[model samples]
Target: MMATPAQPDNGNADVRAVERQQVDSPFFVQTLSRELSASPRRIAVAIVLAFTLVRLVWAYALGFGIDESYTIGQSRFLALSYFDHPPLHYWIAHAASVLFGTGWAIRIPTVLMFSATSWSIFCLTERLFGGVAAVFSVLFLNLSLFFLVSAGAWIVPDGPLMFFLACGAQVMVRIIFPSPGEKEPTIIWWILAGGLFGLAGLAKYSALFTLAGLVFFVIATRHRRQLLTAGPYVACFVGLIAIMPVLIWNVQHDWASLRFQTGRGSPQFAPSAFARMVLGQIVWLGPWIAIPLVQSALHAFRKGRTERELFCVALAVPAIGYTTLQALWSGAGFPHWPMPGWLFVFPLLGARLSGRIRPAIHYAITISLLTLTLLVTAVALGGSGALHRLNVPALHDPTEDLIDWSPVAKVLTPLRVGRPDGPAVAGLDWAEAGKLDFAVGEIAPVLVLGRDKRGFATRSDPRLAGRRGLVIVASEEAWAKKGSGLSCLPEDPLPVARVPVGRAGQAELTLLVIPVEGCIGAAQ
Candidate 1:
């Protein structure tokens, strides 16, 4: 036994050593650090590319969302601004559609814009924090559900808004807090900041909150002297010039857009609404990421002493604070409203979490990917009618919202062509009109019979008044009520086609396309 003991169990020792190595430094962390160390920019670019690929797949997998359909439908007629948001994304969507044609291709512009946004965030974070933090910031930003799916891929204002806001913040950071030994920011930098901020305003109204943050930073910080210089004023003037289109449009329309926006905030206080809004934001940014972001934001606010900390706190506090408080009013605030302000906190979050050997980030990312995969798979299944076949309840299945009007289009195309009068299509409301309009494409004009027509009201054709067309009512009950009142419709007009507008097996709504003759005014 003593002689045999001399062998010394080398294989067991080797296995133990390898286990210790893994315990000390996870393979994931090691590979991540090694890749990051080689080139942070490359890692950032790779992240952007991978996310973009996912977005492309997602965009094609599901139909346009309600708001996306509305944007696409209304953007066919260009305007200075839109009722729901600024015109930049609408312009982008229109341009993308012109170049690539409609369908999922319209989302390409947004997907690409978010890629630029991620790069901007990376550059900003790197300049303020470090390369590792920058990479993590991009990772976290892309991992967030709202930022990833909605802002990243949807044909909404957030994509362009976030891109411009991030770019503006990066430029402003250079102007406000130049690195040690760096030259004073030139007028060009200020001008660039203003232009970018203005472009952000062109993307969404919430950009003003961020712009206010910038103004406050200058006033509250040691950089107030910059106010004495022409730079700040020039930036303001340039920003004003950039947003002139929105102002002009509002003026021309009797400030209808502004009034509408202001009207969204109800006077009644509701703590439940506030709680819901907060929870919505938490859900939007997954709990893992949101918890860190809140911690970073609070840390910046309470104990931050550095110039970068002051800057971030200044920019972040206003939007997040204001939106959260505004949510106390039952009608005010959306989950994404505070996102612009929260955007400035990501660098802080990156800095706070940088170089930490924690499994949370790894697990968060893994969970996010898994969640996204499950969501995408479910969406694909729903779109393909597989989920429908499983008897998934319409109420329980969220993918029902993703169902497009392609089936409706198939039924309406020949009917539209057969009518010599070339009747306009109509829907009960803006959402219905949007889906129908998108489906009909360039074949016929689309109109909303209801008063809440949104952008459609502004673009309504007078000629559609006297033309006979099909009216799409979602339910038999709805058609029974509204269809009977339209004098132009037959006394007992039969549905041209009963099309299901949701997942194949379980219809969310049944579209009753009743033929009518010149009843637009009465319906309205």
Candidate 2:
């Protein structure tokens, strides 16, 4: 007979199962504060909560910046896609407005996206390295000025793009390194990853860079054969399907979106342009974070411990290379265009710097402290009139593009109210059009009166073509010297109000009354 087998400890096993279940529950996250040193889960929750509170305060400290104003204008019109970017940012802001009614309330979605991004970073880093590395990654990311403000505080496409990109990246990591009992990354997970990538594309066209990164990883890894499998194809199909709304919109508009984006690509290379791109990256990422990100990427590529490590580095290349070459050919590019790639680098940095994170830990803390100091000080100084009291020269004017427009609105509102048919209001470009729309769009129809159409091109109403209107042009006196406002009107008009809007109060406002036959007749 076989030796008597020891009876299983059923009661102890049941107790352990209950503990595991409790730990895995989302409710357990907050309790980790009790064991903060040993639990990354609780640490992540605390960091995210703290970051959320800080961003909430920052959001209310100032009015919307120029880009925020533009996005707000777009939120008024719901479309499949807009002239500038995908519509998701506007859609989300629109939802926020419905719930909270504009003002700083619109920025709530951005704060939430930032939180999700932080959590995703934690999960991704944890999967690749360990819990400590995950915590470091969250701190590293939140400390970067670009990530802290532009990506977090502002209502821009990057926030949503980063959130989706992080989600997809985390999913990719899961697929690459399944848990102990899992045999393989299921087809369902691959489908889910593809869907996330698709949603990212819906957020911004730059998500193509992410797709390219994924493809590169698959090719470089031993999972190259997966392309022959249904998983890769399913992912591609899902992504394509997810972006269908954008495609449909473009199709309906004669592919205007595609043409517009394609035109932005550089036709040839220029070192100066490439240098500008590099400079932008350095400024955006901050020296401390940027240096380590690059070093980590290089190290991962040269001496990666496993296929997963190398694959992570591959995710960053397409965006970085594309932006760099685009800058070379175009002679200049936006600093934030390459940001999606940098998102991948953070997790890799956490993993690469596992044991060597001491130096960066201090740097992250210092930068966070200094940045908060400068932000609070700036707000305080402006509120105290110290900024205006400096009376700096025009070149050094801190308030050049940022002026309170209530005075101008005060003057224009009566004129608009006094008119019959609510005479249309106009501006020479999208910036003025958007600003005027925000200022007093409710008083009358607002139009962009120039060749650079933008969002207003589709909004131009034939009925308003012959209507009387006022055009407000806010710019430096130098712009006036160049006669920037004259090209939009058929006849000369007198100044209705010269209101101080920006630095030196050099902005101009003029009256233009179309003939009874209308502006359409005048233009012809």
Candidate 3:
């Protein structure tokens, strides 16, 4: 190529000027700007406020589904325990129902529990670390896919479990961190902490993770050497004994529920299961997960350990560790297996951009988070058409599906209508029987047990065996295939109704009806 320096006088100079203008264009400037441009505090406030609204509003609009129906039944009955989880949630719901009433009313306690836990997370992180860490942890805890969904949407024992977990953590903070120069924490707070944990144990077994964390901190910090000399363990013992109602329930039922949960079997570990679980946590935790999450972890080894980071990191360890183990083994698990991760929010966030945010930055950040929440909510509620802006699944509506008991129950109800027949109902599938129980009430006869512990536990009690005038319920196909002999049915079965099955959304549930025989042959 020939050098053109001699032509720079006019044409070359004009070309150079045009190149300068191109470099200064708006697109180039915008491309160089920060992806997120808000003050951290504004970001934090916006996230919490938006999450609170979405959860409460969406939850109220929805109807009770399968699990809620069972739990409400348990609460009204106030048993020592249920086949799933524990009895604490039922006991709490029972109280809520007394005041709030059944159906949507009992959910008030769940709503309150969520609010308290959230505030605890906010305060704990802000005090332990710094504004950046606080915001980061809060965003991670609140916005996590599992967490956001569980907090307001689900009516499980987890709501109370999380509440007590947060309450216990807050009290520990006061006791461990102590005001500036205080020598020892007040005895009453320690007692209260013990009591809260005692109740937590009744709510869910996972709460034991918190107690384990406390024991770990005491040993890790070498404070356990003074444990016997410091305070009374009597109050703790009393609180523990207070939850004996659950223990008694277990004892009476041959510990079936607990044994069932503990004895869960899985085939083998899958390499991809652990990987996918981690990926799920990452999306749920959001961007903040990368910062204080990593920084706080490393900060633990520094000369002057980041105290706040330590607390949050230590708190989250149990949940993460347990979930990892559960993923490796074969058994039942849930996305909320990592629930305790939320406890870390306060400390980690307190230590992480916590200063001098601008006004425009606030609105910009709020809008960004709002967009994320909206998209997530859309996917969760089973309508992501508009948000196809992202490549996420569009079908995950947890509640509000009709579940198709109408068809099976449809043909049978009329045949026995106004007649003084027995309350027998039959099912070849668990869903059909459960759905019927939902519609006609659990007292309906012939609620045949499902093959799984979750189903069998409800109806396989000796009390429900071979009752006269019982109705048998199963899917139309299953009923036809095994029409001659159902374990719960008599030798001679009578045809009652042939109900057509239908699909509701993505879920398929159908039922068939037959007369409940007085008795089946031995061991059926």
Best by lDDT: 1
Tens digits of per-residue lDDT for model 3, 1-524: 98867643665776886566545545533332232233545656666677777677655655555677556544555566777777888788778778876655567667656766776666665555545555655655665555665654567877878777887777777777766777777778777887888888888877777677676777688556637753437546755785787788778878877887777657677656766666666555554443445555555646776554556667777777787567666634555667565455435533433332232234335635864776556545433222222335674434333233544545656656214444455444444445555555434443444354253355444244344455666665565665555454545665665554433233243455655545332222
Cα lDDT tens digits for candidate 1, 435-485: 777777567777777667788877877457465654454455466555555
What shift in Å separates residue 202 of candidate 3 from its native position after superposition? 1.1
Better candidate by lDDT, 2 or 3: 2
Whole-model Cα lDDT of every candidate shown, in order: 0.79, 0.72, 0.59
Query: Residue 204 of model 2: what lDDT?
Result: 93
Which residue pairs of candidate 1 clash? Answer: none
Clashing pairs in 2: 268-329, 270-328, 466-518, 466-519
* Candidate 3 lDDT: 0.59
lDDT (Cα) of model 1: 0.79
Identify the candidate with maximal TM-score: 1
**Candidate 2 TM-score versus the reference:** 0.84
Candidate 1: residue 495 lDDT (0-100): 80
Cα lDDT over the full model 2: 0.72
Candidates ranked, most accurate by lDDT first: 1, 2, 3
